[model samples]
Every structure is written in structure tokens, then in C-alpha cells.
Target: MRLFAVLLLALLPSLGQAAFRCGTGLVDEGDWPVEVEERCGEPDYVAVYPEASLPGIGIVQTVEHWYYNPGPSSFIRRLVFRNGRLQSEDSLGYGFLPGAAGDCNPRVLNEGMSEFEVVRRCGEPLSKRVTWVASDAYSRYSERRSGLQGVYPVEEWMYEFGSNQFRRIVTFRDGRITDVESAGKPQ
Candidate 1:
């Protein structure tokens, strides 16, 4: 009986994939994002990541995470969107009520930090872009003359906290934060 209980516990996570229900509406994995939104109404939070690759072809798949908190009795449901379609759903176990957390501060941002840490500290960016940066930007001028000729991809994230707050641009190279720049003035 103990072994059977353990097996059932292990299977609990898998059971969550069995379609998402909101009120009287039902949403499945392959449903479009519009359908879920219509059923669940506007979500509490919406985060979008710029681009991702899909199978076969190189597509600009806009990946997004939609967070919904139905009520105090329901868990937080995170619906993943890939290319404007529902990809998956995850149960966050508990929901966060309004005003539960403080806003992220861009002033504390520093170099040599991980991407995840940046997001955790500064929240999601208003915009993001990946570009090819020349090696000379970070390499020594002497090395450039010595024939180190190549470019690497770098990711830039922009944050705008409104007119009262300063905007910031965070740059990442090879998945690690390399620079942070101020783009907005304090009011």
C-alpha cells in the first residue's frame, strides 16, 4: 500500500496536464491563447520573451507566460504561450495577492550577474533584443590589431519604470550580464 501511494504521488504532476478548467470553460494544451484569455478573462500578470526557435523552420515564436489567480481557493496557473498558441500549463501551488511584493530596483544592478538573477532582482524587461557584438568592444585594442576578428551574440534588455523612475539597459554576453547603462533621467 505504501508503494502504491508513492506511485500515485509521483503521478500527481503528470495528472495536471489533463486540461485546464476555468469556471465552466475548458482549455487544452493545443488551444490558442485567445481562447484561454476569453475563458479566464484578463490575467494577473503577462510576461513575454522576444523570440524562440520552433521545429523545422526558424520562426520568430513569441513566447509568453500568462499568470492567472482565480481566487483564494485556487492555485496560481501559469499558461505558456508559444507562437500565440497555448503550449503548456503549470500550477504554482499558491497565488500571490495584489501588493504582496515590492517593485524591482534597477539601482542595485551590477555586472557579472546571471540572467536569472537579473530578472529576479529587476523584473522582466519592457523590451529585449539579441545582436552580434564585435569582440573589440570587450577585448583590448592591442588584441584587435593582433587579428582577433570575430563577433559574438549579446542580449540587451530595456526597462522603463515611468517618468518618475530612471530607465535602464542591461546587456548580457554569453548568458552573463556584462554591462548596465542608464537611459532615462530622474524626474
Candidate 2:
């Protein structure tokens, strides 16, 4: 039973492909190479990332993350995908600790919440109204703040939106968060 369970656990990753979404430019394993302009909004890092071979399949991907607290950690969840499958989801600690995720949940942004409001809670939106032309998808992103100097740096917070409410949130640095997509109330 234990051996079977372990095997199932290993195979589970290949299954449930729905949990994974391929990025634009670099289509899953086969299509054209994905462009950085399409993924990371407006190129603003110490150095721009270059295109590389897909990690698993033939897809292309870019990795960005946040850096922050206990474990003195990094929220910058790293990942890259070139094909219809996932290249990686190398995030630390499942997007935030249990209690922390709960604390971060504040209602999803609606008519009242301004850009500044979003920043107040989660820091800066990594990509504002980030849109992908090929599939007609979009995401609004943000990152958690970093700690004081000499501490862990690179804290990140992400909020992805499709038209409006997205289903994914990621912290690149050391930031943590609870699901906010559900204010759970009616719009």
C-alpha cells in the first residue's frame, strides 16, 4: 500500500494538467518561442532575462519571485513554461503559510478598490492589467514588501486577473497571503 501510494503521488504531477497553464509566446512544447515583453511587464530588472530551452517539455518560461521572512525566505516563486505543460512551479511553502494566507485575504478588488488600495495590502502590482494577446488572457499582479535592510530581500506578491477576477496568486519574495479572489460575496 505504501509503495502504491508513493507511486500515485509521483504520477499525480503529470495528471491534473488543468492546474497548469502555459504562457504566451512560448506555446506548450511546440509552438513559437514566448516573448519576455508578453510575460514580465515592461522589463525592469537588473538585467533582462533571455530565452532558454523549456525545462521539461519544449515550452519557454520566465521566473520571478519575492524574498522575505522566517526561513528568512524567498517569495519569488520561480517557474517557466514553453509548451502546453508546466516547466516548473518551484515556489516555496505553497504560496504562504496556513494562518498567513487567511490573514491576507481582504475582499477581491472591485469598484471601490483603487490601485493604491491594492498596493496598501499587497505592495506593488507586478503587472497592471497584464494581458496576453494570443489567448486573450490577462492578470493584475502584486508582490509583498521586503523586510528591513540586511534581512532577506526580494519579497514578491502576485495577483493575476482575467478580465477582472483571476484564480491565481503568487508571492515571489518572502511574502505570504490568503486567497483574496473570494470576498465570497456577490458583485
Whose lDDT is greatest here? 1
User: Each candidate's TM vs. the true structure?
Assistant: 0.47, 0.19
lDDT of 1 by residue, 1-187 (tens): 9999999999977766767677688888878878887888887777665443323454334557777765457676777776677877776544445544534677667787545445545677889987744445553442343243344345899987678777888987534578989886645
After superposition, candidate 2 runs with Cα above 4 Å error: 1-10, 13-48, 51-76, 81-86, 93-187
Expressed as tens digits, the lDDT of each residue in 98-123 for candidate 2 is 22432123344433232222443454
Q: Model 1 compared with the native: what TM-score?
A: 0.47
- Residue 104, candidate 1: how far off, in angstroms? 4.1
Over 4 Å off, model 1: 1-15, 53-59, 71-74, 99-187
